[model samples]
Target: MARDEGGATDSPAAAYVFRVTVRIDPEVEGVWTEPDTFETTVVRAADSPGDPGWLYFRDNLWRGECGDEAHMRAVAEDALGMPVDAIDFRELRTTQAYLDDLRAAMADDLVEFNAETVDAALSKYLGSSIHVTDDI
Candidate 1:
């Protein structure tokens, strides 16, 4: 199991957290109003076991407000220099799901890490790819 900073195991039902970074094109006009990167958490529904149902900040820290799909669309559009309609954010996966995929990619070799579990294997595979939110 994955342990938190306090050394307790992370809840299987807890939200998946991600730190998103988008590079802003300097050619855009006017002063830059937003940071280059932001973090958000996706909460999976208990009944829906496969993926998360909503994306929002743990607190109202994202631009002084919590966000949903609509807000993410606007942020991605501005950051990526594209129209909101042209952007797609469907690929964002939950942390557990991501780890499962990684383990699957390993195939039979995953047996070696079975004792430690897929989460440990994923942590080793993704070394530095994992990021934490600064707000919480």
Candidate 2:
């Protein structure tokens, strides 16, 4: 039932689109000449009803060509500036899955608004993985 920063009572979730780039560490020389990168989107409940605010990211996730757990950990640790063990990664939900979750999470809100309208708003970003952070 929360509202977005735009003061729209219908839009209760805030969404973010990120371009994630994973690359091999330059120090490790290998046949792999390119870095792996992907785009991801995350959405979270607005801080307060009618509070319009969102965060942005600059750097991308980078890794080395080794393709080992240690190497992957190094890339995440370096890019995130946090211990590898501390980071938690979760699989994103599909559009249908997200909609189902949203419906469950916002059951009360749905009673106040039309479910179809909410689905339409969220449908535009289908197929993108979502990461729900604690900040939400």
Candidate 3:
């Protein structure tokens, strides 16, 4: 959502931002010893799940979300331009309508996801990282 100079929030955006925070061990010499973190916000249109542009989300989501920790960390590191030591899939900021539409689309394509239901498909891919909100 956009906010005017009056400090009031506006309507939600048409796309969603997947914000992921990562902790990195700084390589700088003698400047710091503790780890630092940065968040990367990846924006994607609130399009139908069938759209080709949504492939990146499907491609990066592992069946077992935490099975490949290194792979997940790499994704965050690539986006943040730093070697990430840890990752936290913050949230998917979106509107209620977009989320409902996505779930409906997923429900219709359960076969493609190899799951009996839409929720199962979502869990297989995103785990518990999804958080729908109008504050996008």
Highest TM-score against the true fold, candidate: 3
Model 3: clashing residue pairs?
A: 1-136
Question: Is 1 or 3 the stronger prediction by lDDT?
Answer: 3
Candidate 3, run of 10 with poorest lDDT: 10-19
Residue-level lDDT of model 1, residues 44-106, one tens digit each, is: 212122234321222112222223546665665665454343222222233555334434644
Query: Using TM-score as the measure, what is the rank order of every candidate, best first?
Result: 3, 2, 1
TM-score of 3: 0.59
Q: How many collisions per candidate? A: 0, 2, 1
Cα lDDT tens digits, model 3, 23-119, are 6665687666443666666554544456665544455664424345678668657766777665544444566776787788788778877889888
Alpha carbon lDDT of each predicted model: 0.39, 0.36, 0.61
Kindly give the stretch of ten consecutive residues in candidate 1 with the minimal lDDT sum. Answer: 54-63
